[model samples]
Target: MAARRITQETFDAVVQENVDEFGLDPAEALAEAVEQFESQGVDLTNIVKAVQSGASEDAKDNQTHTVLQILESLRGHVGTANVDGMPADLKRFTEQCKLGFAQRYLAAQKDAYPTILACCRKVDGEKASLLAALDALSSLTDGQPDLLDAGGREFLMGILREHPDDPAVTVLAVRAVRHCCVKHEQNRQDLVKAGVLPLLTATVSRYSAQPELLCEACAALRVMTFDDDIRVPFGQAHDHAKMIVLENSGLKVLIEAAKAHPDNTSVLSELCGTLSRLAVRNEFCQDIVDLGGLTFMMSLLADSLDHQDLVKQVLSALRAMAGNDDVKDAIVSAGGAELIVMAMNRHIGNAHVCEHGCASLSVLALRKPNNCRVIADSGGLLVALQAMKAHPKALNVQKQACMVLRNLVSRTQELCPVILELGAEPLIRQALASHQDCGDLAQAALRDLGCEVELRELWTGKKGSLTQ
Candidate 1:
């Protein structure tokens, strides 16, 4: 076997020995050490390959050891080190990690991640110890997902299995799982394959009344359904969402959990957003309604009209659910049109709520002339136009508002004059001019509303034209 290179500690000792015993200067000793290693094909590329006076070197090294110092207490259980202090050490490390990204980076550089993972393994069965370790692992892997290797990933899942009923431990562990799989597609795929979705759904079921636990668990489930990893060409976000809904019964679980926290706006917002993510198919859209999700959203919207964040998420969920043609009818039939208009008018300045609100109207009006008339009667068309005027710079709001207008006038042509009189032409023209992507929709809205539009002639009917 080829000889392995020496460790940094060994190399440093040699350098010190060269300086003290052989009377060589620090720089000379460093150079000699480099030459000696390279001559033997030691490949010192990973080595720092630098030397400094002992005192100054140690001072510089100590600056990054604050994290590691705490782990020392949990390093050896049988020795003078107290195993009972493992939780405190882990918590202290977690707090240090929370100080900022700089501390986490320092810890990673000092090999603190493996040490923490080892500490977690050492205090495997203890509740407090596992919570502290998982918390530390979560913070340490916040922006540094690559640190969660395959073993660490399994360790987290194992802990979840061991403490299936423990809220505190599960929360901390799922948070760590979320941090690892967020931007890392590999970990997400691995975890999902290892059966993480069912555990997440079970968390919602077992702790339906626990708002904090529900939010944390829901957030983890949502992260698993994300396509945020830019490194991959395509993500299985849709597939994962389907698995959660179909294979794991995630939709029913979430809707049931949502009922437990009607007053907690934060949990409701998270639940609605996750529900939106899981609305991947027409049947799923219908399932949300069948599971009483539609009624829940309508009630939430009607009750929490003053809550802007919850309103936005509820509108977005309604928009996602409206993809089903039948649900469109259901939304209009259940007085959703009026409630949505009220929500939008109340939060007109919030571009997000208005954007989702108009899009929901647009979807609801698609191929449903009766829904269009309902919207017209409920002043949905007027609110959409107002949304367009309010968020002129928001391209999504502009595009979605244009779409709703087009759908509204598609069959209900009599309402065309009403929209035109409301000064929609200029805004449609502005949207067409400002956002390049609104080309077809803006012109279509203008045309369907009985207005003149710029028509580009693509075929000159000339010989040798490239249009052919």
Candidate 2:
């Protein structure tokens, strides 16, 4: 009997059968089929060339399904063993095919921006296809900002505007914005300029029932509002972006998102982070408090004690919100001081938590004598002191801890001796000598501790004048 000859159709049938019948991954199934053919001494050179050539056409089509097919085909070949030792022509063909597919797909997306924008403007039956196309474009523009130009960003905003009620479409659109802004400040600025923040906040509010959408929307807001450049300098609010976020009711949306998805840690973490960024300004600090931000954050910390990421973000938000006297008092009224100290004890080795925790307490201690008393009474001072000693090399922790000590001692004379009793002087002096940035603050703290003469002498290396 003559054996049946293997052909391209035979391999395709085997792959399709494996995929359709056994539900195997196409790449794995293709790999298995290739191995079977090789076992039968069937050369795969012609098959590789055929697959590579097909990928070129698939890429040119520039449709989601075609691109996905090309990706799967490439994965299949790369997953198959011994492909590296194949003929140099096959190897080169595979490499060139992959490169060409990527270039062609990206080129198609770049050229299709206007078409995508028109699709985004459609509010009819093309929603699904539009969403699929947006998803594909998102993948194409993941790390390629050139593909996500101003027109592309406007199209994304259009999706959010036209389909505010469509969770799936909104999620894709927001995720595309997130991908655009992840590592690109210009994209972030552009998104902000395009008023994506309001759209994102609306997405969070409209899709409160969808945890996935809330997470993506919040994630985008987190990235868009991440501006270390515009900071609050010298007790003045300088972050206009944050002001815009406030104007659009961004905080209300985030709080609502948190309430809607209390169990979603990712959503909660992003919400807390975005709120922290917004609260950097004093004007927004009171707004966060008015919105019950302090109580919400304390509850999150209390409930999410096991989630270090969530707890750290909550602490950061608390630090930012605590800048206000009303918020500080509100935090104390809600047992926030104890919460801060408890987080410090819980995540001792977590430098971020400790640093933010101390920073929050320090903020609360500033100009609020009752807050200072509340912190010292809640054992917050001891916690900050221990945090300083434990993470001595952590400059941020030390700096924040010194600020807490300074605030507690400067305004609350009753707590000054308590800080010294906790042996905070050595830590302050060590921080003074170790970290240059923390020196002035640490010296001020030491002076408030009644070590002015000693600090001045140690700082200047001269004890000529004790009275200046």
Candidate 3:
């Protein structure tokens, strides 16, 4: 009950004592020590019991365990091996690369991407082999987006097109598409143009019961709407998001599909995040409210107060939707203000929830004076200050907490002295001094809170300076 734990050193000492002092055999001594620890109620979950080390560790046989060898073997197997049975080698290769970041990167460096893609194409009709190959492709493309070229994009769309109804195949292929699109703007535009959007919305519609498939599809859809590629001068992120919402009926499909997975925290989290990203335009923000997303998310946040992940996403959606003034008033009217504070207090240690919770409160308090008072009345100020203290190193938390304080005191100036008395000035100054991005927002928060802060001016109306 109290962790009932034993260190490996202590356990090994007892085992050695049995071997040397009691004159027992090594194997028998190990067994005796295990039995003795179990009999005394010691938990051995963390202790590494005796086991043979992996061959990769041995300097004697490095090439035998290398992923490169496995990739070559897989390529040969897929090229000639019969597809009548499950490709055991392909499955093994995928399993090896699935968990290790370095392994996947190494595999990608060995040109494993093309091999895996070709295998997926070759194993088209074989469901088991196709799944294994797709899993392998997903792993190879995890952090190696540069490996994904136009051919790989075509192959991904082909898979989705060929196996639209098969959740097993579509899920893996959609995931491969997601891994390809992240931080790769050209791929995002190419896949969306290649008709990946409707296929994704259709996947959600066809397989709402399969939460795993829906999660992948949702995540993929969200990826297509990203402008993460900094090298590109312009990105089609906004256009892709609009297509998902306007052309593909993403809102209705997602909101309808959401009905099937209310009890699942992970799926709900993804769906909330996708909806937030889609809330870019005013009418789009209103569309989320019109399509029952707002009410559903409020209910989600209220129902799943104890779930940290869900709360964080729900608060994010709320914050995004509040970009519309009417939605802002609506959120406060529905008692979302107090739920946010309560959620922050419930999961105070989670920096994500605190950041989103503060951002949501900040947006709600932007121009609405009454909402500001409602948030403050619900201990919003204290919760924010607590987050600033709890996660000092979290720049986003510091920035958003400063933002919430600024917005909270922006309209309702009465609460300024109250927050300052709780020592809000030093934290604001600390955030200001610590983060470069926090300089202006933290200073604005300090200035708005009626504290003494240095506000820099860039223009002093110098003669002929404006022309330059």
Candidate with top lDDT is: 1
Candidate number achieving the greatest TM-score relative to the actual structure = 3
Q: What is the TM-score of each predicted model, taking all chains together?
A: 0.81, 0.67, 0.83
| Candidate 2 segments whose C-alpha is farther than 4 A from its true place | 1-133, 139-147, 183-185, 228-246, 280-283, 452-468
RMSD of 1: 9.3
What's the distance in Å from true for residue 74, model 3? Answer: 2.8
Per-residue lDDT of candidate 2, residues 307-381 (tens digit): 889989898888878777777888888998998898889888889889988988988889988888888889898
lDDT of 1 at 13: 74
Query: How many pairs of residues collide in each model?
Result: 0, 0, 0
- Compose the digit string of candidate 1's lDDT tens values, residues 298-367: 9999999999999999988888899999999999999999999999999999899999999889999999
How would you encode candidate 3's per-residue C-alpha lDDT over 317-413 as one tens digit per residue?
Answer: 8998999999999888888999999999999999999999989989999988898899888899999999999999999999999999999888889
Model with the higher lDDT, candidate 2 or 3: 3
Q: Which stretches of candidate 3 lie over 4 Å from their true place?
A: 1-64, 78-86, 461-468
- Rank order (by TM-score, best first): 3, 1, 2
Residue 100 error, candidate 1, Å: 3.4
lDDT of each: 0.86, 0.70, 0.84
Alpha-carbon shift of residue 441 in model 3 (angstroms): 1.2
